[model samples]
Target: MLLGMRDDEEMGRITLAQVAERAGVSISTVSKVLNGRQDVAAPTRVKVERLLEAHAYRRTTRSAREAPLIEIVFHELESIWAMELIRGVENVAKAHNAGVVLTESGTRHAPGPEWMEAMLQRRPLGVVLVFSTLPTEVKQQLRSRSIPFVIIDPAGDPDPDVPSVGSANWNGGLAATRHLIEHGHRRIGIVTGPEDMLCSRARLDGYRSAMTMAGLEVDPDLILFGDFHVEGGYDRATEMLSRPHPPTAIFAGSDLQALGVLEAARAHGLRVPQDLSVVGYDDVSIARWASPALTTVHQPLRRMAEEATQMLMRLRAEEPVSTRLELATSLIVRKSTASAPTGSPAGRGGARS
Candidate 1:
């Protein structure tokens, strides 16, 4: 009877660990219940929550760390685009004297369970996910832990509750296509990334809109899906060039793909701007260094990264942040694009007239 009374007192002054023991579950399970995670079974959640309320258990809160660190996660670490993002974030992070930790999830745009577990264990001041999505349960856990996070260039349509930063992809695409149209090229081809990607879809829509406004038919054959890689761009460009009615100009989804397109034209003994014109997206460093400086849509990747970092800092301060932020995009015309050659769709065919 004395032991039973002591056990009751222990349950009454419960900590998370003690709550877990009383509920016959793991510490993480108790945490899930407290975080309001949807994955937990309804009955278990209810029972655990009831016990928590009965005990008047309040989670212990800790003061903010003196030297808080921020975590930055990437889908892929390669490419000038990723470098620019890192530079931007580092610039802002230094200003706040916050240490930055960078990690890559291999080729995946989303972090795995292991990554999530480690993140929860470390509990950084804030997290920045580049071109990635956060699962609902993970978001809940972060919220419960008082960890703030921001998504940069979300891979797809982000949840309404998720804060995100991105460029005006549709406007960039429209401007690129319009530049080609104004150059008198009616046989324009486009190589875009996976259709499931929101940015890809938006760019494609922008391309179609520009073509429609110019009263040009958008041939299904001229639109190709690519993996947003150099090899994919080369292969797609090669295949399109072999078509019976090939395009006079091409828009590659990324600068790396544009480089491949350039190589593909070279393999066919076609001179850039002379025989085949090309335009690219994301005016990374290579865009300017290419033999014929690339004509591209500048997505302001660095600025976007900096903006996302600033927003995350604000979030960590318990300040309100805008749910969506979009940076402007501009078209940079270079030597890569020119008027269509003779006998091409917009040349002797008189599409320009």
Candidate 2:
């Protein structure tokens, strides 16, 4: 009605009457602003801003973009093993023009002065924790500050509200275990990750599920829990093999752990596949080069790292995303696994009766 608009409500879309009623402003006041009147006071300007935001106004080219600062906290930065993950995360952050600050918490000095104050003072766009187990107090502090976060290998439900992105750890574990089962190996065993890691438990659950699905009853004695590194894998594998009727097939929860298992098997005069078939989660680069070409489940490390970066950027923009992001997992077959060894269990065990 004001500017060559149609008289019908639907023809030209929402009318001033509708807008005025929704905004709780007088029709005359709306007219003054529409007609380029300069008589509005400070309160009216504030009201207009609120209305625009409530209506979900899309930002046009002129809106200034805020430069976001992101923090990546790690428990251990000195390990060469963690470098690949760091590279993936840092590369993604740089591509988005976001500032990345790296800090090692729970280090020598007990995270004394510097770490506690970092998140609260800067109020970063989001925090990315790379396979670091954060203490409960630290988690609560972040939540209290209303900070968003993504954890790579966190121990528990990251936060009821914040979104998290990581590879399908449980499924990865299942896939690795299933591959061993498919190759006619029973006596399947596991060398797990740290007890505190949700990933460790998830993988263990997957192993149990896979065995159950195969109609095989799991022997609690066959389960060996350990750390994520190669040494931990070796130690746990040794314990499993020491048992009288040790596992003929072993599933190591991580690639590093798998390497250790391989070594332990060799030390006991056992040949891979011929002696003990091995399957490993996390098909890291070294998995292929390991003796007998270690068969493993491939986790998308770079992809997961990239996703964490992207999620942080979107959250900073107050954008929408899935609360629980899960990635795909697949099993990769290699020489490390083969037909069940002769004289071992069969169908429910390895080769023989």
Candidate 3:
């Protein structure tokens, strides 16, 4: 009954019951409007929304607003790369006085509809997606509910309307390739992520660009495509090294892949930098722990995650944010690479057991 009366008891007190009464509707109807539920009749919804704006019926309390909860979804939860991204998001969430919820998609790079349904039910302040994509229907649902979202290192080409944060992958690839070229490696091999992934394509393009600039004929026999994982790297490296004229150096699309390459070298009894050189992308923590610390292109995965969270915060506050953000990538030089051997021996038939 505390509609618009000014009294000490009712001061700044606007409850859903009062709103429902004033709008000539039930409390459930008011809830439907608040939740952006489409089941309600258009006229009833319009009346309820109009009254809500007039009386300013905020759904969140002061405490809830102060420490809003946010959600981050990822394709997988394994590996140091994912951990670094999580740490970055946690840091920003702490600074913003927000709490974070993590969800694993449990599927291919795209989050399924069940994940969207859960997110809608929880109604977090905003969402951050890493290496995942949303379906058009899910995007519409989020929009109807006024839930903002940002993507980090999207698995594919994101919708133009979606906001995203990523590193300069092409530049990273180019730099990694050029570093080997500078060290006198002409027959350089490359193992990249899936061919369908945008990041993989960009990195591969960058390598091609660098090779073209150096006037090195890209050897089709040395280029391989696989997932950005250790196994992929191992398989690709093993196959390439067993060729008739194996590459003197190899560029892996990820740190995990680089480790696999190292294992492949060992299995072949070839010493790193002595028989072959290697470069990797994403200077994850494990890179430093590798035998000959990885020479890599620093993708700044943590920074990208942090920036994406900040952008989501801005969106949650109804503030402006850039549609897309690209952080700079740098080359981290380590001991993994060396000048191509003066008298390179022909490739053996295959790696040793």
Candidate 4:
């Protein structure tokens, strides 16, 4: 039994008074730590956290004044997929008659301390994060307040400790590469996302697998890391096209980067699909609007967000939810890709610049 627990008290319920007494602190101090007040010293916070963890403390009741709001935090609000994710969260929040609060805070890893403090003050019904991982302190703060959170991780890498939703990044990469191979692209180049992200690595591995399966040589020089943006795509594509034996097809990894590839091809006086076939990932809204459309991988971004929001609701209701959910990705073929050009270099077992 806990030091301050009475025999008549509930088995798992620990009151603030009991926790305060055990920690040798006043009730107000405990309250400050619970509310994520910055005034609390680091040592005091750590001590309180340890005590709370040991006792398995959980806030059983929410204040009546707390608004019916669901908060969605993003590292970058300007991302192309942000609107789709926001719409998904809004759809679920509307069904529950709850307002959706959107905040752009923190890095790709976790929300910052300022965001955590403000979130505790708001005391939303639940939270939806567009990050792969959360700091231990952030996780503890949310759990201590009984604030459920779910991550919509597009990176295909999820934190083992939390519930997350992602898509099949490896499958998407394999599908994209195979599609190019089917179009007779023997010498294919890939501009995958950043090197540090697992999704990028997974996709690159998938590309490699497809190439090996197709009896194609995986040239190191044909592979480039991109920032998943237009400029990165353009720069990488331009460099590849400049090579003596340029690839017949280029998988730009992202729709925005694919757009860059198209721009680079145009600047080099190369016609898309005719001179250089292009493929992209993430069939976003602008994919179909592109000049020749984009042959890309369709990542279920909105569905992932919707599922993450639903998981939050399940968590709030004390219902069972999967720790991780990975959705399937499909190839969306459009006008941008075609058979490798003939007579130039494709027929000669090489690629044209």
* Candidate-wise lDDT, in order: 0.80, 0.68, 0.80, 0.87
Q: For residues 1-353, what per-residue lDDT tens digits would candidate 4 score against the true structure?
A: 11222432567667788989988888888888887777988988788888877766777666675679999999999899999899999989998999999999988788877888888888898999999888887887787777889999998788899999999999999999999899888889999999999999989999999999999999999999999999999999999888877888899879999999999888888888888889899899999999889999999888888899899888877778999999999999999999988876533332234
Model 2 / residue 26 / CA error / Å: 40
Model 4 weakest 10-residue run by lDDT = 1-10
**Where is the poorest 10-residue window by lDDT in model 3?**
1-10
Q: List the residue pairs that clash in candidate 1.
A: none
* TM-score for each of the candidates: 0.81, 0.70, 0.80, 0.90
What candidate 4 gets wrong by more than 4 Å, as runs, is 1-14, 36-50, 53-55, 344-353
Clashes of 1: 0
Query: What local lDDT score does residue 216 receive in model 2, on the 0 to 100 scale?
Result: 90
Q: Per-candidate RMSD vs. true structure?
A: 8.1, 11.5, 7.3, 3.8
- Which candidate's TM-score is highest? 4
The candidate, 2 or 4, that scores higher on TM-score is: 4
Off by over 4 Å in 3: 1-67, 154-156, 344-353
Q: What's the C-alpha lDDT at position 96 in model 3? A: 75
Candidate 4 or 2, higher lDDT: 4
lDDT accuracy of residue 213 in candidate 1: 97
The alpha-carbon lDDT assigned to residue 26 of candidate 2 equals 80
Number of backbone collisions per candidate: 0, 3, 0, 0
lDDT of 3 by residue, 112-192 (tens): 666776675577778888754566655555554456788886344665668988778889889999999999888999999
Instruction: Show where candidate 1 strays beyond 4 Å.
Output: 1-60, 64-66, 106-109, 154-156, 344-353
